[model samples]
Target: MRLSVLGAGAIGPAAAALAASRGHEAVLWSPSGRGTMGLDGRIAAEGALSGVFPLRVAQGLEEALASADAVLLAVPAYAFPALLPRIAQAMPAGLPLLIAPAASLAPLAFEALRAGLGPRAPVGALATTPLTARRLAPDRVRIPAIRAAVDVAAVPAAATPEIATLATALFGHACPAAPDVLQPALANANPIIHAALALTNATRIERGEAWPQYELMTEATCRLMSALEAERAALAAALGYVVPTLAEALHRASGVPQGRLAAMGAAIAASGRAVLGPAEMETRYVTEDVPYGLSFYLWLAAGRGVAMPRTAATVAVLEVLWGRDLRANPLLEALDAAGLPRLLREGIGR
Candidate 1:
C-alpha cells in the first residue's frame, strides 16, 4: 500500500510510522514543511509511539497528492473546502480519497466531489481515525494504540467494498465497511467529547492554566457528559445515524463503569501523558466543529424541530468568543441542506 498523509501533525506522523511498520510505502506532507521523517520504538498504550521511523517527506500538497494510492485528509475540517477543490483539480479521477474521522458532513463532501468528478470518482470516507496518536518529537510520533475498531464507507455506496478492502490491507481487521459514508461521518465521536470539554474548560484553556481535563470529568462532569451525549444522539438519530453510547465508549477508553470513577482517573494517570488534541485554538476541534460538527448537528436538530439548547447555546457563546458566526462560515453555508426536496415540495413556510 502506498499512503499519503496530508498533515504532519501528531496524528499524521504517527500514522505514517504505523503504515511504514506494516510494510506500506508511506509519504508524509506538511504545508509548513518541517519535521524529520522517521519512526522509532513501539507505541505505548495511551501514549505516543516511540522510535524513529524512516519515511519520505514532501513539502508541498501537490507533491504529496500526486500518484498516491490513498490520500488521507488530515488537515482541520476548516481547511477542507479550500484544499479539497485543489486536490480534486489535479487528483486522478480513479484515485481513492479517504477522510479520516469525517463527521456529519459526508453528504456535503460527497456532493462536492460528485460535482467535481461527476459522481463517479472513487472516494471513501471514514467514521473514525485508524490510530490514536501524538507527535512526541519533531521527527517522531507516539501511537497510543491503534483503535480497536474502524468504520469506513465509500461516498456513493458502490465504492465501499473496494475502499474498505484497500484500507484493511493497511489497517488490518480493524477497518470494516459501513452501510454508507454518512453513517461513519455521523458516528465520529470527537465532536461530542471536544465541544463538551472545551466549553467546560474554556476559562482554564484561555487563562493557560495547566488543567488536567481527563481528570476533570468526575462523577458530576460525567453526568453532564450524558446530557451532551443525548444532544448529539438526538441529532444523529434525526439525521438517520446511530452512535455508540457514551457509557460504552468511556468503558472502552478507560475501563470505567466496571470500576469506580476515581480509579479510572488513576488508571489514566498511571498511563502517563495522553495528548488529547491540539494545544491551539486553530485546532480542528474548534475550527472544524463550529461549522461541520456543531453547525451541522444544530441544523439537523432544528430541521426536526428538536430543541438543542446546549448545542445552540454553545455555538452562540463560541461565536462571540471567536468573533465569528461559524454557522454562516463559507463551508457551512456551502454544506447547508438547502432545503433539498424534503421541504421544497411541502410548501409549509409559504
Candidate 2:
C-alpha cells in the first residue's frame, strides 16, 4: 500500500516512519514545505520504533495524493476546517481518508462538506493517535510508545471495517470499531486533562518556566479533572453512548493503572515517561483543546439540555485568560444542534 500523510508535525513524521517500517511506500507533505526541508527524503525514528527509513517528500498536495491508496491526516484539531475542504477538493473519488486523534466532531464536519464537494470517499476518525511522539529535529522523531488499540469509526458507519483494516495495516496495531463517530469523538480525554493542567498552572506557563506536566497533577487538580469527567460522561449518556472514563482510557493508552486519577499521575511520574508542560501560555493545550474540544462539549450539552457547570466554567475562565471568544468555532456554528445527534449516527444525508 502507498500512503500519503498530511501535516509535517511530530505525528506526521512518526506516522510516515511507521508506515515505511511496515513495508508500505509512504510519502509526506508539509503544507508550508518547511517540515520536510533538510530531510533529504529520509526519516530517523528513535525509542519505541527505531529505524532509518526512506521517505518521499511531495512538493504539493496533488503530488502527495497522487498514486496513494490511502490518506492520513496528522494535523492538529485547529487545522481541520481549512485543511479538510482543500483535501476534499483535491483527493480522488473513493480514496479512504483517516484522521488520527480526531476531536471536535471533525469527521462529521468533513462529511458535511463532502456531500457538496462531490467526493465519494469514506472518512474515518480515531479516538487518539496511535503513537506518542515528538519531533527531535527537522528529519527525526522520538516515539515514546505505540498504543495497543485505537478506537475507530467512519462517517457512514458501515465503512468502519474497511477503515479499521486500513488503519491496522498502516500502524500494525489494533483498530477496534466504535458504534459511530460520536463514540470516538467523545472518547478523547486530552481536552479535559490539558484544561486542568493549564488552568491550574497558568502562572507557570505564562512565566515560561519548565515543569513536568504530570508531576503537577496534584489532588486538587485531579479532583477538578474528575468533576470535568463526570460532566463529559453525563453528556455522552444523554446522547445514548457509553464511552470510557479517563482512568480507563489512560490505562489502555499508557499502561497507567486504573485507580484514582492522582495515583495514576503519580505512577506516570514515577515511571519517568512524563513530558514537560508547555513553556508558554499559547499552546494546543489551551488554544486547540479549549475552543475545539471543551467548547464543543458545551455546545452538545446545550442541545441535550444537560448542564455542564464545571466544563462551562473551565471554558469561561480560559476565554477570560486569553481575552478572546474561544467558542467561535466555524464547524460548531454551521451545525444544527437539534439535528446533530441523528446526523452523527447516520452520516450526512441519513
Clashing residue pair totals per candidate (backbone < 3 A): 14, 0
Model 1 residue 144 CA deviation (Å) reads 2.2
The regions of model 1 sitting more than 4 angstroms off are 34-48, 110-121, 250-266, 276-283, 321-323, 335-350
lDDT to native, each model: 0.63, 0.86
Cα lDDT of model 2 by residue, 251-309, tens digit: 76678778988888888878856778898967989888888889988878875689999
Q: What lDDT would candidate 2 get against the real structure?
A: 0.86
lDDT of 1 by residue, 205-317 (tens): 66666766567656765555567678888776766667766545444444435354435554565566344433456556666776777777776676576778877777887
Q: How accurate is candidate 1 locally (lDDT)?
A: 0.63
Question: Model 2, stretches more than 4 Å misplaced?
Answer: 117-119
